[model samples]
Target: MSRVRNGLIGRGLIPVWLLLPIVALFAVGYVLPLSQLVLKSLQSEGSWSLKSYLEIAHSPTFFWIVLRTLTLAATVTLICLLVAYPLAYMIARCSPRVASLMLLVVTLPYLTSVLIRTYGWIVLLGPSGPINKTLLQLGVISEPLQMVFNAAGVYIGMVQVQLPLMVFPLYAALARVNPSLTKAAQSLGSPPTDAFLRVTLPASMPGLVSGCTLVFLSCLGFYITPELLGGPDDYLIAQGISLRVLILGNFSDAAAQSSLLLLAVIMIFLVFRRRIAEELDDSSRFDDISPLGATASGLAARRPIVERASLLSHHVGLRIHEALTSVRRPLLRFFAGLALLLLTLPFAVVIPLAFSDAPYLTFPPPGYSLRWFSRLFSNTQWLDALSFSLRWAGLSALLSVAVGVPAAFALVRHRFPGRLAIYLLLISPLIVPHVVMAVSLFFALAGTSLIGSPLAFALGYAIIGAPYAVVVTIAGLKRFDRTLERAATSLGANQITILRTVTLPLLLPTLASAAIFAFIVGFDDVVFGLFLSGPNATPLPMRMWDNIRLEISPQIAVVAVMFLAVLAILGLLRLFVGAAIEGRRSQAKT
Candidate 1:
């Protein structure tokens, strides 16, 4: 038995077999459903036709919606880049402890549900919210501004939600840059501003590109933020598709819209695929100086014109730098602090509003009370939704780990044909928009009895959760020391024994992180719940979405606070476990 197992492992058969489960899942859950969607889009009254496409091309409403979607996505991407660059740069230049704390602040809102964040914006930006209230008290404005339910609200909400996606990639890129290179440029007679522009900026291009691509792609598929915050005129493509299916009962039209949207996503993804991969793999060092040197030599040949232009710019930059030298650091700190505060503004507002004595949404409650908390707990609908969310999120995490762990092991431990293709297939969910996946899953499961079942929700959520699991686990496996496994083998242990005693034990931290990420993916999901969730299986996000769209109350804030409390508890527990583990390791070393 041991020889057979060893032979299978040696020949790479074990790794190949381990990949089969995820491959099968994607085939049934992703590929076939998308194929069905395409087919449905092509058929009209059971015959092939382009009627839906033709209608979309001719309809001014749809044309405007598509145009708006693209325009919004582009604008949001640009704004996020502008706002995130300075913050990321500031964080990168900080001490490691400070950088970690700043990153934690930036990422906390990201872990919260988009629905919750959008609600936070509603409370903060509404006429009765804090901003307008403060402005009124100070006599800044005669009346409250119409901030929500318009294009302004959409932009503000979308940017706040997407800011972290931009900051993280930019931080990663900027952090990898060698500080000496900037100093070297300054030493070679470049001004501080000029050095950053030519040296630091160019070095961070990979991250800039990655961050912009992610933000743009995400904005393109935004449904929750726009739906809850924007007016009817601010309609987007995702909303159009949802309307056609859910309200109009026109599956063909919805499928056609989804197909076009999916095509756009695929095209953009393919164009930036290589750069995105480089960023994710942390493989782009930006250390090659040959290109910079070549450009400089080329410029030297045209020095008469270039030198005059460069001299004027350098002189201007020097004067400006001198003028602002005393205030530059303080200015950067202020802007960066403001940006971080913007990221946490939603929770900062919502937590306080949860305790408001007022029956409705208000800032700085007349008096603090637990009425909303009591109401939320006593409400059956809220309890049922919360129950459903927790149960399915837990199941989804388990399902993701069960399949993702083996696939990670296979990809890391063995060389095989089609390995790259397999890895891509596993991570494709992350590339495809959540709305598109939700639509595809809806069509795929409609023919089965599982359409509104908890099992169906788990399966769909797992598809979204699995990519994070595979990526995190693969990273862990790569960083793991294989020597311990060899030592176990030398003790006459079989493959299974070695895996159980040496591999799994050491990989526990990685697996736990992966599971937490997967759980969060399911828990924070609103896109999937929009299309697939039914009366019995509605997740908490879905319930929250309903309340925000229909009624404005303090109970919603209570739910948001409760969810944040849960997350805080989980985070603290993780820190405690990590400290205990480190202490044990210290003892062993001693």
Candidate 2:
């Protein structure tokens, strides 16, 4: 038996057993269902045909739904971009401490489930809620506005929910901008506005493109917000697909709709990508600027080929430059503050309302007490679901780390076939919508024994969370020196020994980050939990979903506040660990 195992291991087949759970998941959760959906789309009344797709194309309601979804997505993307750009820029420009705090605010909502966040939106946007109540008190309007159950409500909820997705990418892009460029621009007699437009904006275009692409793509497949907040006329393609599958019991129609949305999304991204690539390529073709046009008067070559500063900047005296330009930096700062406030207010709103003495959801309560929070602890249903979610998160995080660590190792340490393709495939989940995955997985698991099982949910979440683990671990591993591993090997260390001492120690910080990210991905997921959860295994987000749908409850606010508190604690821990790792690395170098 030992020899047989060794032979299999030597043949690269031993690890196959370790992959059984993941392989079963990918095959049963993704491949089979997608295949079935495609096959179903092909079948007609009795035989294979394009009839289902044709029927969809021919329907006026289908076209309207498609148009509505696109419009809603575009509107939300634009609004999010408008709101996120300045905030991201402000955060990136601030001191490290301030930047870290700002980043925490932007990312804190990410730890809480989207279902809870959307419910917060519901409380804020409802007629009797804060916005309308304030407006009525001020006599801005005698009657309440029709904000909820309309496109307006959907836009607010979706944009607020999805803004972080846009902000982070743009922040990353903006963060990459060199401060020297801005200084050089100032020294060259180019005003800050001109400098920003001519230099900063062009450099940051990649981030904007990336952020917009990510936000728009995600918005395209949104289901819950639109369904919960919007009126019947506000239906998007995702809602249409759900209606077809769940209500109408027409799997073929749902498949066709999903396929169309997928195709259109791919086409749209491809077109935008080509346009940006062409633009960049065209910019690269431009020759050196004329002496007359050179804003930088001095061009000094630090390295042989690349100039250290622009031509005009080289001429401007490095010191004793003119007064530094500061544009309505304050105005921009104020707007950034307002945007952050708007993004986070729903969460803030929940805290105060959670303690309301009245059963009704009211702010500035007649009396405040901890009774509701006390009630939360005694609510067995809520407690069970929360416990279930925590367990699922822990399990999923472990599984994600398991799959991700190896993949990260392989990608960083080895050269293999299809490496880039595999990397893209693994991270592709981040770009795709949750509802699509939920629908696909729903169909895939319909007849399988794995359906409605905790193991199945864990596997499902592992896939969703795997990319985050990969991102964090790869970042950590990339920054790590491979020479340490080589030295260990040379000292007669085995693979396990080298990994235990050299690799694992260096990768600890990253591992922690990956673990946190994996837990967040699983804990915050709503669509998957909604689709895959059984009575015994229903995650907190799904339970919250049931509560919100069945009736409006204030206990959700209590839950939301607690969720945020846990996230804050986790985030702080991650920061401290990261700092300690950095300190150790610095000390070692010293």
Candidate 3:
């Protein structure tokens, strides 16, 4: 039996078997749907043609919408970078305990549903909401300002929603930088600012780039925030696609637009693919191929003009450094605190509003009561939506785990041909925009009776969620010690017995984390729910989205609070599981 197993492993059959389930899931759930969408885009009246693409190309409206989407994504990425850099730096510089707390604060908004966050902004920025009401009361403004339904609201909501994406990556990069390098630069007679720019900043460029890429790509597909906050002119490409399909019933045009958006996403991924992979694997050595080194090498070819510009910038930097040296730390702390406050502001607003006695959304309610929570629980539609969301999320998590764990094993434990291709295929769902996936899935499922069924939602969500599972499980596998497996094998244990008795138990904590992540991905998703959900299968986020658009009510706040509560419970559960795992490990060592 052992000889047979070894022979199978040597022939790469084991890895192939392990990888098969996930490959099939991706094919049916992702590739087929997307292929259908592409084919639909190229079809006109049952004949293949370029009509839709040509129509889009010739339409000035399409041009502006695409341009607007790009501009919005770029602008949001820039703002998030500016706001998150200081906060991430501060967190990195703090003590571990304090840093963890601050990091949680930064991630608070991110953990909350985008719908809930957007609704929070609605309550806070509405004409009669808190900010305007306070301003009116203080005579800061005589009348309420138009804040919510405009570009200002879109920026605020998007920045708040996406800020943590930027912060986490930046923090990871900053935390990895050697403090001694900065000190060494200072010891060489460089100012603090110069040392940071010359040493720390260059080292953290990978994180900066990764964060920007994530934010930009995410902003491109943003539907909930912009739709809820922006005026008509603020319509983005994602909104355009949604309108074409949902309102106009124009699948071909929507498909064409989706194809273009997908193309842009693929191009971006290809451009930054190597950097993202290196960052994820922690394989990049900053000292060897630093951004500064790259710049210097590039500048070597155009020395004279670049040298003069560099000297001028250096002189200006020195002067600015001298002037701001004493207050620099204070400024960084202040800005970081401000950014964190912005991140937490929605939670602070929503929690109290959840208890509002009034039916409408207003801060500092005339009286406090549990009316909304009662209504939320009593409402049949809300209850049904919640039930469906929970069921679908569970199924999605289960499917993700079943498919992802073996793929992780194959990728991490075996070497084979097409391994890289398999890995890329598994993670490609993460690169594709959610709206595009939603559209593709919709097109593929439209002809089937399963269109709005729980199975449909589960399969769609699993496609996206499986990537998280694979990535997390791969990390766990990389950390796992194979010596224990070898010991078990030497004791005459077969592969199945070794896996059952040793591997699964050791990987329990990581598997649990992966499941929780997958569940959250399914639960918080609004795009898939939007396109695939029917009257009978509506998810909670979809329900909340409807309430947000049709009416602004305190019940939505109750749902938002529920989301936070669910997040907190999951987080505590994760910590508990991790501690238990650690305790067992310690006991075993003893």
**Among all candidates shown, the one with the greatest TM-score:** 3
Which tens-of-lDDT digit does each residue in 1-590 have in candidate 1? 99998977777678868888877877888888888998889989989999999988999988889899999999999999988998999999999999999998987888887888898899888998889999999999999999999999999999999999999889987887777777886788766665666566766777899899989988888888999899988999999888887889899999999999988987888788777555234233453434454235323332344335557797775776566655768878988988898899888888888999897776878899999998899999999999999999999999899889999888878778877667877887877888888998898898787887888889888999998899889888867767767766877999889888767866777888888889999988988888888767899888888888889787778988888888888888777766765575455346
**Model 1 clashing residue pairs (backbone):** none
**lDDT of all predictions:** 0.83, 0.74, 0.85
Give one digit per residue, the lDDT tens place, for model 3 in 240-357: 9998998999989999999999988978977887765652343456535444553453233333442345477977767776677778899998999889988988777888999999
Best by lDDT: 3
Which residue pairs does candidate 2 place in steric collision? 296-311, 296-312, 296-313, 297-311, 297-312, 298-311, 298-314, 298-315
Q: Which should have the higher TM-score, number 1 or number 2?
A: 1
Work out how many backbone clashes candidate 1 has: 0
lDDT of candidate 2 over 358-439, digit per residue (tens): 8776665668888889888998988998888899889889988887777776666655455555565566666666766777
**Higher-scoring candidate on lDDT, 2 or 3:** 3
Instruction: Give, for candidate 3, the lowest lDDT window spanning 10 residues.
Output: 298-307
Q: 164 in model 1: Cα distance from truth in Å?
A: 0.8
Model 1 weakest lDDT span, ten residues long? 297-306
Q: Given candidate 3, what's the lDDT at residue 82?
A: 96
